[model samples]
Target: MESVRTCVGCRARAPRAALVRVVAIDSQVVLDERGSMPGRGAWVHRTHECVDAAIRRRAFGRALRVSGSLDTQTLQNHFQRNG
Candidate 1:
């Protein structure tokens, strides 16, 4: 069976393949396209609404267990380009 995860943004359960995995690296929020990044991960939908909600609610830091602000510019750029 396919794995399932919850979207931090929408707080909805979805198939793992339908969500993008995000990891914290050096206080930066990076998208793990391959889902193989070495760290704790938070899942979020690729949609702008979801991404925005995640950021607005400050879910990344809480989900990833980080203690500071994280830079999500790269993640936003990625969605903007691919969206």
Candidate 2:
């Protein structure tokens, strides 16, 4: 069976390939394009809507199991550059 993960933004359960993996490192949220980051990770749709939703809901910290604010510039830049 295919692996499934829920989007932290939309909370929708979807195939692993349908979502992007993210990891928190040093209070910054980074996109794990290869899905091989070594830590707790969160998944979200590739769309901006979902990304913004996750930010609005403060899902990153909760999903990554971090206890403080996270810098998402890298994540935002990735979307802006490649979205």
Candidate 3:
């Protein structure tokens, strides 16, 4: 069965494949492109708007259950480059 995940940015529920998986490692938020990262994962829509919303509202940290801010440059670039 396909899994459902909620987007941290938009709070919309969707199929796992429709969103990008992110995880915190070494205080850095990285995209789990292959969805194989061994840690808690957060889901976000594959769009700049959704990513910006998540960053603007600091949802990544909360969704990932991390303290303090996370560097989302890499994440932004990843989406923007491919968006």
Model 2 alpha-carbon miss at residue 5, Å: 0.5
- Estimate, for each residue in 1-83, the C-alpha lDDT of model 1 and write its tens digit: 99999999999999999999999999999999999999899999989889889999999999999998999899988988888
- Is candidate 1 or 3 superior in lDDT? 1
Give the runs in model 3 whose Cα sits over 4 Å from its true position.
none
Residue 5 error, candidate 1, Å: 0.1
Q: All models: lDDT?
A: 0.95, 0.93, 0.93
Query: What local lDDT does model 1 show for residue 52?
Result: 84
Tens digit of per-residue lDDT, candidate 3, span 24-77:
998899999999999999999899999999999999999899998799999999
TM-scores of the models, in the order given? 0.96, 0.95, 0.94
lDDT of the structure predicted as candidate 2 = 0.93
Regions of model 1 farther than 4 Å from truth? none
Best by lDDT: 1
Q: Which lDDT tens digits does candidate 2 get at residues 1-83?
A: 99999999999999999999999999999999999989999999998889989999999999999997899988987887777
**Candidate 3 — number of clashing residue pairs?**
0
Residue 31 lDDT, candidate 2, scale 0-100: 92
